[model samples]
Target: MDEETFNISMRKFLKKVGVTSQQEIEKAIRAGLANGRLKGDEKLPAKMVLTIGGVDLTFAV
Candidate 1:
């Protein structure tokens, strides 16, 4: 892929995933806070798993 095309594609992909993931995380956090499961100032450990075909990746949040 050419530089311009690659940049555009990556930016599009990142924007979509980043926005969706952030919204979902915020919703979950709100639910936890409402149910007394989170104290609002806790450093909680979080994990995310992403798989694409035969490749898998793990991330900490």
Candidate 2:
């Protein structure tokens, strides 16, 4: 792929993933707050799993 095409596709993919992940996190946080599962000033443990083709990756957030 050309540099221009690769950059455009990468940016679009990253933006979509970033935005959707952020929205889901915010929704979860809101639910936690409503149910008294979380306080406004606490560090929450987070994890994420990603699978691509035959590879699996785990991340700590």
Q: What TM-score does model 1 achieve against the real structure? A: 0.67
What TM-score does candidate 2 reach?
A: 0.72
lDDT of 1 by residue, 1-61 (tens): 6999999998998799889988999999999999999999988776766545556654544
Residue 29, candidate 2: C-alpha displacement in angstroms: 0.3
Q: How many clashing residue pairs appear in each of the predictions shown?
A: 0, 0
lDDT of each: 0.83, 0.84
Task: In model 2, state the lDDT of residue 51.
Answer: 47
Give candidate 2 regions above 4 Å deviation. Answer: 48-50, 54-61
Off by over 4 Å in 1: 49-61
Candidate 1, after superposition: displacement of residue 59 in Å? Answer: 7.1
**Each model's Cα RMSD:** 2.8, 2.7
Q: For model 2, how does the per-residue alpha-carbon lDDT over 1-61 read when each residue is reduced to its tens digit?
A: 6999999998998799889999999999999999999888999777766545556654444
